[model samples]
Target: MTTTRRPGAYHCGIDAAMDVIGGKWKVLILWALDERARRFGELRRLLPGITEKVLASHLRELETAKIVRREEFEEVPPRVEYSLTPRGVALNEALAPLGAWGREHVIGGTAVTPGG
Candidate 1:
C-alpha cells in the first residue's frame, strides 16, 4: 500500500491485489464500509485502535484506489460520508470466502486470550 505501481508493473494478479490491500487496516476498513456509508466519526467508532491520522491516510489511499467513495454534503456543520464503490462491493464479495475460512479455522478453533 505504501508504493504505487505503474501500469503492467505487477508480476501477477495477486501481487497487484496485495499492493492495494497490504496494510493491517485496509481490508478492515473495507469491511467496515461493507454495510453502508459512514461519516468519519462513525468509522472511528467502529475501529477502536486506529488513530485519526492513520484512518485519514488510509481513507485517502482507498479513495485513490477507487475502492471507496467519499461524498461531502453542504450543511451547517458539514458532513462527509464514505462508502464502497461498485468495484469495492465486488471486492467485498470476493473476500467473503476468505472471511468464512477465517471464521471456520482461525476464530472457531483458536483458544481465547485474556480479553480476546
Candidate 2:
C-alpha cells in the first residue's frame, strides 16, 4: 500500500498521528473496536453512514499503522475480525477528554448554534 506518511517528515506528534487517522471514519472505526473484536458486517452496523469502500480503506490504513489488527479464522466460511491494538487503545484513551468536552459542550449540555 503506497502512502505519503513518510518517516521523519512530520512537524509534530499530532501531525504524524493525523497522517494515520486524518479522516471522518478512521477515528470512529477506532472507537468501534475499542471494546471488542468485530466482524466487517458488525462494524458496518455499529457505524452508520460509512461506505464499504471507505471502511475497507480505513481498515487497511489503520492496520498498516499498527493501530488495528485483523484476524482471519479458518472455518466453514472464512471468518475475519478486527480489534484495536495496544497503540490504538492508547490513542482512544488520549481522546477521552476530547469526547468528554464534546459531550459537555455540544451533546448533553447546551446546544450552541453558530452565529447565535
Candidate 3:
C-alpha cells in the first residue's frame, strides 16, 4: 500500500501523536489494548459491529505509526497479536483524564467519581 504523506503543521510530539491516533475508532482500539494484548479476532469480539476491513485498516495505520506492535508467532498456523507501544501507553495515560472529563461532563453531566 502506498502511503500518502500529507504536508501539515504538527507542531509538537503531542500533535504528531494525535495525528496518528485521532480517529473515531482508534482511541477505542487503544483503550481495548490498554487492558491486554489481543489477537485480531479477540479485538473484533471486544468491539462488536466494527467491520473487519476498518479494523484491519486501522491496525495497519497504528502499526505504521509505531503506536502499536504486531507480533506474529510462527506456530503451525501463524498467529498475530497487537499491543500498544510505550508511546501508545503514555498516550493512553494522558487521555485518561480527558476520558474522565468527557464521561463526567459529556455523558453524565456530573462530577467524576474517583476510580468509578
TM-score of each: 0.90, 0.89, 0.81
Pairs of residues clashing in candidate 1 = none
Candidate 3 off by > 4 Å: 1-8, 11-15, 109-116
Q: Rate the local accuracy (lDDT) of all candidates.
A: 0.89, 0.89, 0.85
Cα RMSD, each candidate: 2.6, 2.0, 5.3
Error of 3 at 43 (Å): 0.6
For candidate 2, which ten residues in a row score worst on lDDT? Answer: 1-10
lDDT of 2 by residue, 5-83 (tens): 8688889998888888787888899889988999999999999999888789889989988999999999979999999
Tens-digit lDDT track of model 3 for 1-116: 32343447667777766677776789989999998899999999989888898899989988887879999999988899999999889888988998988888867966556787
**lDDT by residue (tens digit), candidate 1, 1-116:** 24475578889987888887778888999999999999999999999999999999999988898999999999989999999999999888988999998888778978456887
Model 3 is weakest, by summed lDDT over 10 consecutive residues, at: 1-10
